[model samples]
Target: MPGFYYPIYFFQLDAIKHGVSVTFSFYSLVILNASNFVGRVTSGYIAVFVGVINLTIVATISCSVLNFGMIGLNSLVSVVVLGVFYGYLSGVYAALVAPLITTLTPDLSELGARMGITAFFVGGIGVLIGAPISGALLTSKYIWWIPAVFSGTISLTGGMVYIIMRSMFIRHQFKSQA
Candidate 1:
């Protein structure tokens, strides 16, 4: 989530360097935000049927793949397309994260504390390091792909962690029932 923000923040510069028009560059940002809005609204309603954790895992994985696709794209159209896809998927993942956390916590009374602690750790670390790492990659020139790869890998890893946690939770539930 925060990982994706780094590239988006630098998108204007990137688009200009790639010979994309100023109008389209700004449109790229607008398209991303608009699609993100749609994704957030739709995902919330969809989560009721599909489950928040499952939806989040799918969205994260999709965002990861889209981020990877961003690396090989040099055309304005390609970048815009990928940006819209990434925005939508990322929005879904972001919207569901809080609800997923709430579902995972065992005690309703401790939900706020759990959410606060989780947010502090994930947001604190991600916000602190994500931009710096992306900046470093951009400065390297030869290693520009590193930022996309790194962001995608992080998103993929997060999804895997969620999958594992979900499996463990299911196992525990079954054991208690048995």
Candidate 2:
């Protein structure tokens, strides 16, 4: 999520730098937000059928994969398309976080405490470092793709971590049942 935030924070500037039309540059954000709105609403319905953790994993992977497309393209059409997909998947990811956390915890009584601690640590650290690292990449100008690649890789890594966590959770559940 932090990885994706880089673009949400800096995309307008990036668009201007890349010579994209001003109108399209603005539309890029609009398209992303609109799609995100749709995704958030739809995810609630999907979560009921698919389960929150499952949906979150799918959404995370989708965002991770699409991040590569966003990083590699500069055309307005590509940006618009990728932006919308990324926005939607990201929205799903955001919507599912709390539910996913709830699913992982052992005690419903501890849910609030667990969520608060997780939010404080994870959100705090991500907010502190994500943008500055991305900005540093941009300022270095070692390569244009560095920031995008960095963001994409981070998102991909996050998805992989979630996969591992899910597997461990399942294993624990089975062991407890036995």
Candidate 3:
């Protein structure tokens, strides 16, 4: 979320920097958000088949890849495409996050407390600091790609963590069965 959030918060400025009309810049966000809505709605069914962890890992990694694609785009069409793609992938992560948490919890009794802690860390601290860091990277020159790379690296790191957690979960499962 830090990855997606920072880029989204600065998207308008980036678009305007590229000479895209202000109105269209705003519309780019709308397009992204609307696509996000669609992705959230569809993700449930997709997760049913793909499994929450697998789908989340795929979406997070895909988002990282797409953020790298944001580096050199100079057209509104390209921006719009990036918004739609990134939005959908990020939305998938959003939708599945709670379920992912559920899987991580060993006891249902601890779920609510764990969820709150997770939200505080991810949404509160991580997101709060990430945008400013990205903004700081922008400087007066508005070097958009630098921030894009930063965001991509964050997402990639998150994807790697998820991969590690998944492996640990599998190992635990196998041990319990044995």
Candidate 4:
């Protein structure tokens, strides 16, 4: 998410910077965003059938894998690959947002709104910064590969966080049963 967002965002920004026409820029942004719509929605819905908490690990790993794939992309074909991968992953990611809140919080009533807030904050603040910052990384003598590094880092970080949290939850559950 954060990783893909950064590179795509930079791609968008770069296109605009070069006066690539609004249609071109908009289409690029649209393609980039389509990944989330597909990934987040589909995965999120599936999270509903399985335990949301359980799927958290799945979503996290998907994020990491997709992000790494995203990092390796060097052309339009890669973008399409990213869109497919990210879209599916994003679906899971979005689904887990609410489920995660429901599992952790006592009040299930506020789950939707609370999770929405969390998503907004995470997407807006965390991911929003990814592109521009990576773009900054690109400023230094055409170091295009820098974006891949940053995106890869973001994916790995998100995956680690999911793994740690899922493990803790599992341990807690096992202990309670014992």
Scored by lDDT, the top model is 3
User: What CA root-mean-square deviation does each model show from the true structure?
Assistant: 1.7, 1.7, 1.2, 4.2
Best by TM-score: 3
Clashing pairs in 2: none
Please provide the root mean square deviation of candidate 2 (C-alpha atoms, Å).
1.7
Q: Residue by residue across 9-81, what tens digits does model 1's lDDT show?
A: 6666666667788888888888788888888889989999998888988997788787677677677888678
Candidate number that wins on lDDT, 3 or 4: 3
Clashes of 3: 0
lDDT of 3 by residue, 1-178 (tens): 6776865788778778888899899898998898889889999999999999999999999988987887866788888898898889888988988999998898999999989989656567878888889989888888888889999999899999999999999899899899
Ten residues in sequence with the least summed lDDT for candidate 2: 140-149
TM-score of each: 0.91, 0.91, 0.95, 0.70
lDDT of 4 at 112: 72
Off by over 4 Å in 4: 1-4, 11-28, 106-125
lDDT of 2 by residue, 49-126 (tens): 998877888997787677566566577777788778878887888778888889998999999988887866786687
Model 2, stretches more than 4 Å misplaced? 140-142
CA displacement after TM-score superposition, residue 65 of candidate 2 (Å): 2.2
Clashing pairs in 3: none
Worst 10 residues of 3 by lDDT: 119-128
Query: Model 4 scores what on Cα lDDT?
Result: 0.65
